[model samples]
Target chain A: MVTRGTTTATAGTTRTAEERARRVAADVPDPELPMLTIDDLGILREVHVDGSGHVDVDITPTYSGCPALEAIRADVLTRLDEHGMPDATVHVVLSPPWTTDRISADGIEKLRRHGIAPPGPAGGAHGDGRAPVPLALTVRCPRCGSPDTRELARFGSTACKALWVCGDCAEPFDHLKAL
Target chain B: MSGDTTSERSGWRSAAEPSVERVRSGARPGDVSGLVEYTLRLGDDALILSQRLGEWITRAPQLEEDVALANIALDLLGQARSLLTYAGEAEGAGRDEDALAYWRDERDFRNVLLVERPNGDFAETMARQLWFTSYQYELYDRLRASADPTLAAVAAKAVKEVAYHRDHAAQWVLRLGDGTDESRRRMQGGLAAVAPYVDELFDPDGVTGGLGAVAVDPAALREPSERHVDGVLDRAGLERPPEPAHVARGGRRGLHTEVMGYLLAEMQHLHRSHEGASW
Candidate 1:
């Protein structure tokens, strides 16, 4: 019975029912960015199973007003139901708020491979609740592996992304901004 | 941008509706009437400002500024969506966000005077943004610890977004204030024009009273809010405009300037024209 801050079991090990539930819950893809699963984005916060086999999934929205949350909620329930755990309740928690630092290493790789530049670590004074405007230190162009790039707009097609143009490749791309 | 019905624009309706229902209909919680009024005040501020910002989409000085203003507008609209929906639910009336936002007359809006003023120019808009964002940053920062969980949640999320907005406005202020002589003149005029409405932001009225810890008294935020604005002004080589003898007030009491009527008319025109419609 894992609660907050408990680590998940490693791959190739015997998985418990709770672990299996976590796996299914984590596999739900983000509605906007389909290349990365909710697990990859660090949005799938917790999955718990009781002796009665009831599962509770706690997830956080990347943005508070994110319209995609409904889609993500629907998808999470569908995925868990397909895994035979139809009695799943998805709770959206807002406290401790989400940050880009929560995205896993694998998630970064998936984003880069999908031709999107993943966000750098958040650069802000801790405990202030005001994140400094994200300054891209070295946003290497996703199309051409070049370090030369210029930000065009602080926003893009979605709230999570910023528009950038690769100076080397002369190709425009989206850089996922640190939340 | 064509004359399509709401249903014809699935993108518009999906983007417009509140994704989550924060207010559950039961015994309304925590000074229910005051809470409902307080929520409407916040929601109306966001909704009205968003409409003003949306007007800058293709009209900004540059493409980047256009995108930036549009993005800011979208964020405000998102916050408005949640707060308005919650307010409607708390009101115990059948009014949803749409009813409260589009159907209501100008006299019903509860936003502060700063947001309802017309967007005079780019510099004028920045001045309004500077004042409002700084005030919001302080308000939301404290409201994060509200006794009401929903308000706290909204504040926690909104503080992050408004931080960026405050930064954006500050940057523009510095640039325009310290730029060419003509630009500096306009920026200064903009600051003076927006100065009268600044005091009303800190006025503590009945909407915020009697709520205990759930509501933040706007007066308490005065010091820090001014500090933020002063720092930005100092950096931009600007000074606070002298307080006008007569300050505008009464937005909290739903007495807004004549501009509010025109602003609401343009905002609610399509929605009222196409009643009971969904995109």
Candidate 2:
């Protein structure tokens, strides 16, 4: 009677097949943002294995219209298959929904390294859409690290980003919007 | 119950289950009466608006606007897919999102008449967006607490996205309204044109009424939407369109404008023509 909702990845635990499956799934890179893995994006929620070694992997999307979801799903399956689990199941969950804060610190650093601006901390206590206005911090340019930037458009090439240009560096970049 | 639970625990049955079904957790499929109808009303609104927004992909006033509208359309389409898929599951009918979207006739679509209204001009488009997105923002915000887990989850994701959409619309409304005299006139006209359809969005109906806490009463969303939109209008220096004498209704019952037929034809023709062709 294995239950859901348990967190994975502590330094010292009796390693099991489920943990191995988690590592494989977590290593799958995000299709759209290749700099980060699904685990780094915090979409890889839970990976479980039954007694027969059947694997169930749960993931959530950063946004509802995230086009890379199908690719991520296929990639996870393929990675798990390479790890000797061909018949793994991936489920997309929406509860306790995905937020910008879920992007691991390493993922944020990766985005910065890749010339994309990272989002500020999503400070809303509830998913009720009423975000506290004071946290509307400036998005610095990943290139020049300048806080002087202006938005070019609210929407961008992808669903998760907004287009902005740095005033000091005069460089246009994508800022991941805090949802 | 225990026997079914035991079977569900066996792994095979739950492996290929749809996201909506699996995330619904403890709720029984098709348990909520009127759930399908209520879900379709919301789903169809998103679908139709998405189709309308998709029309602006290359045709928007600027290149940035084109990308913005396209991104917004994609988001709405995503929401529609989630909703219509959930609606199909609640119906327990073999229909899926594609079936509901591509197969349904205009008379069968449950979207509000406002969404299917032709995107007349850029100002009109912004006006329409302002009204609809603000309403959706309110709707999804309150709907996060729905008893149905799928609907609640959908609302949780949607509310965040819709806030950005509302900002886009309000930004445009302000730019056009407070700019030139000619631009102000067009924005005013655009607002007045859609005023007739506004009442129907908030009209209390049987589907929402019967669903208890599982559905947020559209009537309850009215005050907040108005408060928010009115603030935008004030800042934009645009007058509130007067309450029209005739309010268009019956969209919840599938009655739509004649233009809906044209919109439906264009949207459904590809799928209807191909029938099951996939890449």
**Per-model TM-score versus the true fold:** 0.82, 0.91
Give lDDT tens digits, candidate 2, residues B126-227. 999999998999899888888776788788878888888988999899999999999999999999989998888999977788888888999988999999
After superposition, candidate 2 runs with Cα above 4 Å error: A1-15, A125-128, A132-136, B1-16, B19-33
Error of 2 at A39 (Å): 0.9
Worst ten in a row by lDDT for model 1 chain B: B5-14
What lDDT does candidate 1 reach at residue B260? 93
> Against the hidden true structure, what lDDT does model 1 obtain?
0.81
Instruction: Summarize candidate 1's per-residue lDDT along A1-179 as a digit string, tens digits.
Output: 56432434432232477899999988899999998999999888767777667887777777655768778888988998998989887766565567888899999999999889999877463247755566778999998999999888776777778889999889999999876
Error of 1 at B273 (Å): 3.8
Going through the candidates in order, their DockQ values are 0.20, 0.40
| Candidate 2: tens digits of C-alpha lDDT, residues A1-179 | 13332333321232488789999999999988898999999989778787567888878877787878878888999999998988788877676668888999999999999988998877664443676221346889999999999888878889999889999989999988887
Overall local distance difference test of candidate 2:
0.83
True contacts kept of 1: 0.31
lDDT of 1 at B81: 76
